[model samples]
Target: MKESVSHIQGVGPRAVEQLEVMGISTVEQLLEHFPFRYEDYAIRPIMEVQHDERVTVRGKVHSEPTLRYYGKNKARLTVRVLVDGLLVQAIFFNQGYLKNQIHLGDVITINGKFDRNRLMISGGTMKTSNQEVTGGLEPVYSVKGSIKITTLRKYIRQAFEQFGDQIGEILPHQLLSAYRLLNRRETLEQLHFPTDTVQLKQAKRRMIYEELLFFQLKMQMFRKLERQGEKGQQKRFNKEDLLVFMDKLPFELTGAQKQALKEILSDLTADHRMNRLLQGDVGSGKTIVAGIALYVNAKAGFQGALMVPTEILAEQHKASLKELLEPFGLRVELLSGSAKAKERREILGALKEGSVDVLIGTHALIQDGVDFHHLGLVITDEQHRFGVEQRRILRNKGLRPDVLFMTATPIPRTLAISVFGDMDVSIINEMPKGRKPVDTRWAKHDMLPRVIEFLKRELGKGHQAYVICPLIEESDKLDVQNAIDVHHQLTQVFPEFTVGLMHGRLSSDEKDCVMNEFAKNNVHILVSTTVVEVGVNVPNATVMVIYDAERFGLAQLHQLRGRVGRGQAQSYCILLADPKSDVGKERMQIMTDTNDGFELSERDLELRGPGEFFGSRQSGLPNFKVADIVEDFRVLEVARQDAAKLVNSEAFWKSNDYEKLRKKLEEQGVFQDQKLD
Candidate 1:
């Protein structure tokens, strides 16, 4: 097996350049690079065009097309086509590039919605790629900036002509037989050019399974590496010390919180390092459990560190941890980029002098100058916010610190295991006692006054409010309703009260200033972008009114609402929804009917799909071809189990059986060369 191939067969340097634009490089990568969707462009007679069903109509241009410009940036090209005496107005919008592709009186088959008056096929989303597109079924690859589907089709067709035979089968014969999977060669050919929808679906499944298996194999291998050779001290939690602290809490811990705490305590007391992930819904008492863990590590004469994604969150952690642990005389210090010259001096001196028992801060804690006396444990908040390299930096701060990561967004258990197998997971699903489910409602633009009246009512009770918006400025299409505009309007309406605004455009310092004003209760309302998603805990804020709520993901809305309801007071979330989208209505409905973030997330996964869930940059999930995280979960599990089996073998690396798998992992940058002196 080769580590990497220079160029895919039959693809020229120019074609290779195009593939690289979409993040494809070598033959292995190209083979693994599956299509985003399979367009079943099977031919249907011109007379068999259904009202809603898509159809391809063969026609010849009756006249020269004319590019017509509509007002305010709306432009389209229109032409009449004659197919079997049925005249269909073929309209194309924002497709000025397509003008060059077509010639006057040219015969063509246009795949679009066939209507009596007009055919509305999106030339932008769909196009006629060469390689015949094989009317039975064909693969459609996604392209990046300037890389068209037509170019991708050409390169793929070239790939098939050249190296189609080089595609190797990685799955074992027994496993393939057990799963009743298609043969490797047949699956590839069918995926590139399928006979029917049934075969296309099967080919897709085979390919998705392979991609998932490769990912699972890599994760399982890393998990093995983490658990096998690492050793952790076994120190039981001091029950008397813990009970003394718990009894002093202003509010009692919930049953779920207690259970989660017990699991963390057990993990910490074990001989192996506590590599665990703590997940709970937003507003659940995940922080308190973390504080308890830090206290335990502190009592055992070892230091603890809690790292956060932002400085505001760090400040919140510092204040809360101080209040909870100050009675025990635990020396807690806050370190961040904004620390005063004298304050940072004191923190660094105390840290190096072995006086600081616990430390909380942002990425600044991972820097070289911040030394610990005896670092025993490390806790991370909003675990996914930090990247892999940043996590490694913090881990290298101490001598293999017991790492624990916490996430406020609840993920499905299968997803949890699949994504984070290196870490033991403990979930706190149930809410704490006496916590009220936020009263959620979906409103429209017409109900603005009603929502404002509700906000004013909350304010009359001396409660703060948060008005959320997705964008910072107004566009011609979307009414701005920006936080800036809202803030001005709000301040003018309620002149007696203070109003503060924040958005992504503001610097961290500016945001922090606005957030501080809101936290201090100086601002009656905080009009802002989604920047308030995971900041300080403001218990006084009881109302979250999100304008254009449909633009936000379900998990994000939950996070925004989490900004409120931190206190014992009842909270309300008013969502302004657009009537144009039914999917948006369903998304907002999931939030209004229930308070389960996990439930909302699964529904979100089903609705918006995985690409929107994981975000585009984080894992490039939306870019995957056939691997539907939701639909292909069975394949994910099977691949995970197979990966576990392979990693267990002492000679798995030596086996010729895994040569293709090994080469694939290497190609994925998972296998670094082991150089020996």
Candidate 2:
């Protein structure tokens, strides 16, 4: 019990507040805050320093050289040290206080993280010989605000020491014994301050493996528990509705769509609830496929629900879905946050009265008062947008409505399984008619004038353009482009042009109006932020200019670029960066090179790795121990095998040996009971 909850040592209300600010509470949570990466600050003898090969050197402070002021207090303290006939230069930064610590010719051993820059081995944060200095790799952790590195190391070390013996081991005794995993206490202790690099690797593996195993077990167990649920949505379609709709489609359905439609159609028509995820890259006809599912439910005289992340997207989906269902004499209603009070009241009344066949909205759909007549099919666009609670709320609305979650974010298979293993998946790998590729490029701030001129020409030709600024308001430290400021700047450039602005802070009505203007091409140069990412499909918009493109993740940049290229015109995406870094260059290259969203997504994961992409932003993925998605494909395969074995029968769920496992989940409030009756 103590392992789960925390009574942290020496932490009072004020310290707790600081830890809470960093999003940590319990002891378990604190333990999960692993090192970002290790920094190898191994103290090397002065003789080990090579002419060309770079290394860290430590020796006595033989002399304190004169501090020559190099403008703006940019002065370095250089000390000569005699050690094993290798002269070492101990370079120091802004260490006015260290001057007294190191008296003239005092015996001092300096330590710094050094690397070869040309012929110079640059140093950082070196320590004097007051404390016992040891040469070894150090761990770096992610921190918040101005917390000193020394402070963080101290706190982490304390946590490890105090709670080291109490970390309740969760890996089954038999499994651990078989796998030869180090005891939980030992692993945690070794990870914080490893005896050696080898031991550190071992600790990392044990922790990562535990995380992965726990999550995989979680997803599998949840699905197992869900399978026991006798409740499921009533079937709303037969051969009649599907044949009727498919025959009317303007083009022939690709085999992939046909398969996806079959998967979705069968799930809706079946008795068990459809907890399925539909994955396809951009330009794939996910909307149309979703429309088919909705239409099936509508034709069967049952209601459906489509939940989206934003009001603009909800409204757009409402229109698009309504248009698709219109020919069948079906009624589709929009119940977004922007709806006038009277109109919203009417919509709710209609929903409860079973008059609304298919209702589409944002989070408003999950309100307690909202009711559905016979909600048989539920679909969430960009499914990762909503949390588990939100999904549960909608499913609980009407007899376990068959849920079909859709995403244009094409995740890799290993990541896909780890992140969304609980959901039965369907792939829609095909795109629609005549979707032209958007030309992409990497650029600097200097390219902005040329980019603007080009967009000006396009706008002059009656082709609308989107000039996107990343930040909505000015940030004190970052000198990046802000939406309001850019709107002002663009207005000056194109005085007569209609420019619309939209961001998160706007009221629903204001956002709707701005988005509608941009969608209808009334706003020739829409100067807004990422608020338009999931909004309407503005085909006529030919240019997409993203300012400070480096600030965006590759996946997000792709999503932004996806807004344009919808129309037949040659769409162009201009990515603007300044003082380009490595990741910056990669993001720009991904945008300019390929329209394959799946490829771009894979590349993005490769660059940033699985942690940020499949981690906390979209929580509850089976965390890897040391198995990298790119590097550890084999381990994933093994985990997949184990998952299949565990979920295959009632034995695993009923076994007494698994009771401790169940209790652990219960303690974390992870595996909760969801009644479906």
Candidate 3:
């Protein structure tokens, strides 16, 4: 089964190259390349076929075939045929050679669209009585670049014939019997050439269960490896000191914040290293909760590190955290890439000598030459921005330190479990007291004057505004407003106020400069793209006007809306859109209805589907061949529970019942560096 695809009969060198292009270099890979859809080519009677319906009909050729040449090497072949004693015309495109083979009174079958009114079948394939049609649920693969469907089908058939007996079952016999599922051999056979609908459904169910079970088992094993025998620092901090620190804060901690802090503190005191994800909506006071955790870590006489995605966010956090923790005699330092050479050297020295209790920076914290004397806690803000490898490198910088990943994007509970199953999760759902929900409204493009008037009134009160556009420049395809155009128009409309432009095309320093101007209130209105969606905090910006709001996903729209409502003044979010589709209209309506990020995320998942919900890049979801995280969530839950149970059973690991699973996991390298003990 591991043999190269060239070993298969009729697969020449050129065919091997094409199969390799599709990532099928081995017999096993070729077998696993399942078809995306199937075509039903069951023969049907012409009298029973409806108008403009796809039907496969058998007929006898009554008229001679005529070939006509059209523009640019295109040809049309038309022939009259008699089906069910009714005369009908069958048309084929670019198959001029069929004219020489098809003849009068030849029994033929065609599969294509049947026009009942004209008694015509266009875009049809014809087969004579001597040729085989192999009709009934024909598999259709996603082919690319000269790989014909018939050629792929032939190759797959030959592969099954040669390697069918070599296939082995990965799932245990007990599971197959308990689930009443077919064995691996039968599942593959039925998936490729299913005999009936029932068999196809059963085959798909088995594959989905197997894929999800393997994924969940991997996650469970990772959790075990991180926690088993991994000793974490038992911080010896005084409770009175923490209480005194909390009391000094200007605002009281929300209930949700307190709950999250309690969880973190419990993890810090435990003997096992902590790997947790702290998630919340924007302005939900998650930063404060993280600040408290950092302080506790500092009080334990250990160093702490906070890594963010951008220099602007790092700078913002440095200021706020210093104001919060500096008074308590915990030194907080900033180490960004743009820091001067001498300043960077000083910060590095302080970090290594234990002078910097809490160091905050961008990705520079993970680079070389930055060593820690007693790094106890590692926290990453906008956790999704950093990849898995980056986080692992930072974790290796210390001795099994406690890690807390913070993200302002509120993920739905279902997605959170599937993506972050290896770690504990804590959520902060409450906003700080005295923070009002931003008033949301939806308007049409014709209502721009009213929105501008509202913006003028808000700016008159010394408040700032943000105008978000979908595109940076004019697009030949999309007719929506662009940032540059909007900036110029707004500048002319408000001559007394300053308008700034910022987009992805700008340099990092330029972006920081623009953001700084906005933060200082020098730029009254900042017209930009979604570059400001993450962690650029400007409290004075109370108004958010999103142009072409329907072009964005619900989660993104929610994040953009969160930019405002940070200040004491009442903030407003205005959506300018005239959606033509029902889903787009529903999206605008949903945004105006609720301000809860979690609720919006759930709806967003439903509206955009799981693939587009978080985008595969940021979702961290496994790419399953057969399992859909959303449609097969029930199966996923069952698989997760079973995986947890199996990993916890010590006797099972030592028993014969585990040999097959152990072998399979070993083949997947799941237990490479893992200790079963």
Candidate 4:
């Protein structure tokens, strides 16, 4: 199965190069490259076929085949055939040589599109009727660079003939009997050239199950290796001291926040290293809970590191955390890429000398020169923004540190289980007390005047507002509003108030300055793109006006709506959009209907599918060849349970019953290390 493509019969140097272009270098890879679709060439009676329908009919040639030369390098062959006592003309394009092979009275099977009125079949392939028809389902490979479909099919057949026996079964016998799945070799054969629809379905089930089971097994192994031999720090902190720290806050802790903190505390005090994910909607007070955990770690005489995606968020966290923990003599410092050289040097020195209790930074925290004194706790904000390798680098800085991942994007439970199956999840669903859900409304473009009046009413109450646009600059392709144009229009509408414009094109320092002014209430109205969707916290903002709301996804609209409604005042989110498609209108209606991020995420997944849910890059979803995380969720659940049971069983790992599965996983580099991407 590992043999090169060149080893296959009829595959020479040119064929191997063409196969490699499609990412098929080995025989196993070639076999795994399943067809995207299939074509059925079953024989049908001419009277039963509809006009312009592709059909296959067996006919006897009645007229001699004639070849004609048309424009440059073009030729056509026409032959008359009798099917069901009705004469029909069969036309083949660019196959002039077929005239020599086809003759009068030759019984041939013609498969092509039939024109009933003209009694003609164009672009048809003819084969002798006496030859067996491999016609139930014909696999169609996505070809490129001079590779014909017939050539590809023939090469695949040759590959199976030469090395079919090497494709051994990877699933255990019990699983095979339990699931009623076909053996691996038979599964591949049926997938490539299925005899019937029933076999095709069964073969597909086997493949999907195998892919999902292996993936879940890899996740289970990763979880096992995370705590197999490592000993984590058992932090000791006084309960009275922790309660006193919480009581000093101006606002009381919500029940959900307390629960999440309790879970973190359990992981922190356990002997094994903790890998936990803290998920909550926007404005759920997740930061305060994380702050409490950091405080406990500091009291235990170990340093803590908090990493965010942007410098503005790091600064905001440093300010808030310092205010919360500094009174107890626990120091908090900020480190970012834009920090001055002297300040960076001093902070690094302090971090190494055990002076800084909590260090908050951006990607700069994972750089080479940054070292910690006794790092025991690590927290990454917006965990999806960093890749798996980046998180691993930070964790390697400490000896089995208890890691906590925080995200404002509330993932659905199904996706959470599939992607973060190895980590313990803590969700804070309850919003803090006194916080009211934002009043959502949808309006068309003609309602701009009324929307302006509403915005003026909110601003009249001395509250800030945010006007979001979809694009930063004008685009010739898109008909939506841009930030620059929207900024100009809003500045004219609200001449008395200060309107600040910000976008991705702005420098980091410029963005920070704009955000700082907005936070200080110096900027009355901020016009920006989606750059503010993540971590800009302004409590006094009361109204959010999004132009071209239909252009954004439901999850994104929800995030922008979260930018406001942070303060004690009643907040409103006005969606100014006139969607043309039903899906777009449904999205607008869904936004106005509920404020639950989890529900919105599920709907978004259903509307856009798993690939576009969180986007392919930041989604952290494994790219399975056969299984879909959304459609095959039930199969995934079953596979996850089975893999967990097998990993926990002592006999499965030690006995010969599972040696093939173990060796296959090792060959795929699953057991070589604990790294997961």
- Candidate that would win on TM-score: 3
Instruction: Give the clash count for model 1.
Output: 0
How many clashes in candidate 3? 0
Q: Per-residue alpha-carbon lDDT of model 2 for 400-441, expressed as tens digits?
A: 678888888788766676556677888876677576778887
lDDT scores in order: 0.77, 0.74, 0.89, 0.89
Residue 429 of model 2 has an lDDT of: 67
**Candidate 1 lDDT, 1-677, residue by residue in tens:** 12233444556667667667777776656665666666556656666676656676666777777887778687787767777777666777876666666666776667665554344443422343442546665567767877777666666666666777776787767668877899787787787667898887788778888778777777666666655566776665568987788788888888888888888888778777777889999878899899988999988888888999888889999999998888899999999899899999989999987899899998888888999888889898887788767777787677767889898887887877665655678888888778888889999889998887887788999999999987787766876477778888999888878988889989988988888888999998999998888757888999999998988888888888888887889999999987468888888888888888888778877887644566642442324567866667767777878888887876568877677777767766655421100
Q: Between the candidate structures 1 and 3, which one is better when assessed by lDDT?
A: 3
Angstrom error of the Cα, residue 288, model 3: value is 0.9
The C-alpha local distance difference test score for the whole of candidate 2 amounts to 0.74
Ranking by lDDT: 4, 3, 1, 2
Cα misplacement distance, residue 476 of candidate 2 (Å): 6.0
> Model 1, which residues run further than 4 Å from truth?
1-25, 46-51, 59-66, 70-75, 82-87, 94-107, 114-133, 142-164, 617-625, 649-656, 666-677
Clashing pairs in 4: none
| Span of 10 residues, lowest total lDDT, candidate 4 | 610-619
**Candidate 4 global CA lDDT score:** 0.89
Cα lDDT tens digits, model 3, 1-677, are: 88999999999999999998888899999888888876667888789999999888898999999999988899999999999999999999999999988989898988888999999999967778898887787788888878998899899899999999998887877778888989999999988998977898999999999998888888788788667766888888999999899889998998989888999999998988888889899899999999999999999988999999999999999999999999889899999889999999999999999999999988888899989999999999988888877877787889888999998888887667765677788988878889999999999999999999999999999999999999999998899999999999999999999999999999989999999999999999999999989988999999999999999989889999999999889999999999999999999999999998888888887898645665654644677777887778778888888888888888447877778787888787777744211
> Highest lDDT among the candidates is held by which one?
4
